[model samples]
Target: MEVDYSDIRVIGFDADDTLWVNETYFREAEEKFAELLEGYETKNKIDQELFKMEIKNLALYGYGIKGFMLSMIESALELSNNEVSQATLSEILNLGKEMISHPVELLDGVEVVLKQLKGKYRLIVLTKGDLLDQERKLERSGLSAYFHHVEVLSDKKEKNYQDLLSHLNIDVKEFLMIGNSLRSDVLPLVNIGARAVHVPFHTTWQHEEIEEPKQKTGYITTNSLANILEYL
Candidate 1:
């Protein structure tokens, strides 16, 4: 229960999986799409190919409907060998958009923890995704009141972490980032001397996986979102 509150003015959080059940919905959709292509490709191959399309699209359109739509199109095209009908691609795009349009659901105990810390800390959301999509999710989650600011960026690199703190007029040491995804959330923040807590989700997106463990930062890992409240 020894959480550090010393000079920690701003607490940054990664939105997906941390605050709400995001990846599950996306995963479910991907699996459904994979089933559609089962006749053309093996499940693992479809997943691997779809993963590559997503990563490539992330660079082009960043996170959100735009990137996801492109991935759907690319995956469908790739699976069909450029012979897929426009009708099929249109259906896939529609499905993807429908998935994104769904309401956001806050994770277990997210409300309890946010209520506990809202008054004491400058809570900010620093999530990487489609700007409008992320914002819409935040608005629907009904937890936006607890956050002072919400940042939707293309990526969560070390530079993004450093730049955000600088723009916020806060020192790196005065911040603490809490969320899932070691690759996006923990490592970059820790590199700048900002403390971080890693709440590992059971199924992270392939692009978001950490290739190696970051053992040096002393970053705390929690099994559940509720467990985070005890630390804070």
Candidate 2:
């Protein structure tokens, strides 16, 4: 079924993978982290432990490189039974610092898509992460001027979308969210009577994965961010 996007007056974009290179850096960092702790555990074990620790620490720490850095440290300590050396810990911290300072690399066609839609709709950024880090990335991304507003949400749940839309005085029916995560960016908006377009990124964090509902109707999927321009 083709959903009408003719009513979309505001388009919310996800910041991370949807706009810039994000998960790739995390994947690279995880590899480096696993190599750092290779003496204590297998690479597979290191990956598993780090993911488990991250999930365990999500609520307490929220999301960002800082929380991920802490999770890596904790996972190392647990994997090595407190035998993990201080030098390794230092390296882990450095890994996160690298990610925080990494240059923002925008995805292909991101600028074109944004540029084409700039005057046609109210463009806004609705990403979930550390506010400071996200702000820094936006400043570095060189694309801040395109968005009417930017929101660094702690998370992207149904209530989060609801509150933001209501607070911004945006009509739910006229709002459309475009992003890389079905769980975070797509389904929540769809549940709130808002439209959504899922632009799947090449890589997705495990926690962000969800079973697509059999009754998907309020949203549509596109091969990439650029493809969404056709429907809009």
Candidate 3:
């Protein structure tokens, strides 16, 4: 089915993996986290426990490096039966700090796509994460000039998208979103009667992964961030 972008006036982009490196850092942190707890359990078990801890604490901590750090600390305590050394806990914190301080790396063609669409369309960033961290990354990305507004949402559910679009005075018919995660960035928009384009990242956080529905969704899928230009 052919999707139309001629009706799209405001384009929202997902920040993390769609514009720059994000999930890769989390994956790396998990690997190091597994190694830190290797004495207590197997790597696979450590990975599973940490993921569980993260989900269990999602409501309490929301999302971002701080929440992830806390989850790692909790997972370490449980995995080690509270015998995990204080030094080990500190090291886990360092892993998150390193991630927080990690430099932003723009994905290929991000600039070209944003630049071409900046003036022609109303560009905005509608990503979900810790506000401070997302702001820091956006400042580092040097792409802020392109977006008219940036929102750091707590979650990307259908209601969230509806409220944001309403608040922004953007009509659903004129709104389009593009991102790397189908679950967060694409599906919600589609569910809310807006258009979305999916550009898969090389690595996606397991939490963000979702199986495609058997029924057809109007959302379009493109191979790369640049590929969506063909649709736009």
Measured against the true structure, the TM-scores of the candidates, in listed sequence, are: 0.92, 0.98, 0.98
Index of the highest-lDDT prediction:
2
User: Could you tell me which residue pairs clash in candidate 3?
Assistant: none
The number of clashing residue pairs in model 2 is 0
List runs of model 2 lying over 4 Å from the truth: none
Q: All models: lDDT? A: 0.82, 0.94, 0.93
- The residue-by-residue lDDT of candidate 3 on 1-232, one tens digit each, is 7888888999999999999999999999999999999999999999999999999999999988999999999999999999999899999999999999999999999999998898889999998889999999999999999999999999999999999999999999999999999899988888888998989999988899999777646688878888888887
> Which regions of candidate 3 are displaced past 4 Å?
none
Better of 1 and 3 by lDDT: 3
Task: List RMSD in Å for every model shown.
Answer: 2.0, 0.9, 0.8
Candidate 2 on 91-134: residue-level lDDT in tens? 99999999999999999999999999999999999998888999
How high is the lDDT of residue 118 in model 3? 86
What TM-score quantifies how close candidate 3 is to the native fold?
0.98
What's the distance in Å from true for residue 90, model 2?
Answer: 0.6
